[model samples]
Target chain A: NAGVTQTPKFQVLKTGQSMTLQCAQDMNHEYMSWYRQDPGMGLRLIHYSVGAGITDQGEVPNGYNVSRLNKREFSLRLESAAPSQTSVYFCASSAGGTGVSYEQYFGPGTRLTVT
Target chain B: LAKTTQPISMDSYEGQEVNITCSHNNIATNDYITWYQQFPSQGPRFIIQGYKTKVTNEVASLFIPADRKSSTLSLPRVSLSDTAVYYCLVGPDYGGATNKLIFGTGTLLAVQP
Candidate 1:
């Protein structure tokens, strides 16, 4: 199972450009999440979805938007990229259910550079 | 949300045991402790998790004390392949506005040959 997959492994954008990082999971998970990791820092949550059509902001949600159209996909969009937005973005999913563990499987990550 | 604190880095030699500790003083009653390992250019993978006491898996062991304010991840017989960033996460077990995990600066374990 491609536990989790991300598209456009690498990308470069201008200061005002916009892009979307795609995330998908085949684990039939009900919870999907987006996170960003800056150099020398830990991953911070950007947005998350409880299930299809449900999304919510996370710790560092500025300049970012997320959509969870179905249980298998979640996308993170940068409306207007900034230098501060350049970082490694990761998407994760978890089998959310009562009596289930909180183990999250992550994608390979998308490296974004904003000039 | 529960916050975690861990060392920035640690050094170990081949065949040695490496223990990385994390502190989560504000962890709630429903919070569980989980650890993840990440290599370069890859995403973090789950190592092990524990609610209390000791939990051991094929890869690692997690030890949580009675107070539950801290937990330790023990990697036995480390090798170069095990050299990676170890993250300690603390969060609740269910879904809620604050159910998301809180990852702090992980411990960069460098295994020497």
Candidate 2:
């Protein structure tokens, strides 16, 4: 399996600019998540999807939106970029089922800089 | 989800065993303790996980006490490459869908020669 893959390894956007971060997983996982990590800090969830067509807000869901068009794809959209949103973003997926281990597979993070 | 507390930083010499402990006082009955390791600019990788007692894998070992309030991640025979931030997460094991995982500022382990 290719595990999880994220697009645009790095991006820089100006204030009020909008962009979408792409996340894809080939593990056929039922759960997918988007997280942001600030320098020297742990990750905070932005959004998540339990399955296709289902999305939910996470701890820090403000300034962001998400969509799960299919089981293998989840996208994070930023309506208006802000400097505070400049951080490394990560996409992760996990198989969800009874008696299954809850280990998340993470993709290479996307580094975003909002000027 | 339960909050986790761990050391901010730890130092160890090469070839020595390193133990990083995380405290979760409000862990629920269905919650499991998991550990993840991350190097610079890379994604975090699963190291080990355990509910109670001990869980041993090829890479590391996870030890939880009977109360399951705290867990320790033991890395044996550490090397320079083992230097990274270690995260301890506690969350319920939902049967079909997992709730969000809260990642606090993890313990940064610096390995020295």
Candidate 3:
């Protein structure tokens, strides 16, 4: 299984430009999440999905949007890129149960640079 | 979601055991403490997790006290490869609207020879 895979390992966007970050998991997890990590800092959740066709805002969801059209795919979209949005983005999936089943599997991460 | 506090950085020598502790004063009854290790330019990986007592895995061990207010992650026989940022997260284990995981600044571990 691929666990979780993200597209475009690295991307550079200009001010006001928009882009979508794609995340897919073959582990058939019911929960998926998008997080951003700044230099020397831990990850902050941007958005998450409990299941297909369900998405919700997270701690830092102001500048982002998300969609989960299917159980295997979760996408994070930036409507207007800003320099502050420049950071490494990661996608994770979990089995969506209690206890140890909540262990999340992360993707390789995408490095975004907004100029 | 409970907030977690941990050391900013720690230094250790190779072959020595390293323990990183996290404090979560407002941990809820259903919340579980989990640890993740992040390397440079990579994604964070799960190390260990536990609610009470101890949880041992091949990579690390997680120890939680009776109160579940604080937890420790023990890494045995560390190497230079073990150098990374460790994050302690407290969240509910069940899936629902509150199934989000919050990450703090994390503790950076630097292993020396």
List the lowest-lDDT window of 10 residues for candidate 1 chain B: B95-104
As for candidate 1, its clashing pairs are none
TM-score computed on alpha carbons, candidate 3:
0.93
Deviation from native of the Cα of residue B43 in model 1, angstroms:
1.1
Which segments of candidate 1 are over 4 A away from where they belong? A97-101
Chain B TM-score (model 2 vs. true structure): 0.96
Candidate 3 lDDT by residue in tens digits, B1-69: 688899999999999999999999999998878898999988988888888999998999898999998
Model 3 CA lDDT for position B108: 95
Question: What's model 3's lDDT at B43?
Answer: 91
Which ten contiguous residues of candidate 1 chain A have the minimum total lDDT?
A: A94-103
- Model 3: runs farther than 4 Å from truth? A97-101
Q: What's the best-to-worst order under lDDT?
A: 2, 3, 1
**Which digits, one per residue and each the tens of the lDDT, describe model 2 over residues A7-108?**
989999999999999999999999898999999999988888889999887789999999999999999999999999999999999887311248889999
Residue B100 lDDT in candidate 1: 71
Number of clashing residue pairs, candidate 2: 0
Shares of reference contacts reproduced by the candidates, in order, are: 0.41, 0.48, 0.48
Q: Give the residue spans of candidate 2 off by over 4 A.
A: A97-101
For all predictions, the C-alpha RMSD in Å is: 2.1, 1.9, 1.9
Would you list the C-alpha lDDT of every candidate in the order shown?
0.88, 0.90, 0.89
A1-115 per-residue lDDT for model 1 (tens digits): 8789999999999999999999999999988889999998888888888889988888899899888988899999999999999999999888863111477898999999999
Chain B TM, per prediction: 0.94, 0.96, 0.96
lDDT of 3 by residue, A1-115 (tens): 7789999899999999999999999998888889999987878888888899988777899989999999999999999999999999999988863223278889999999999
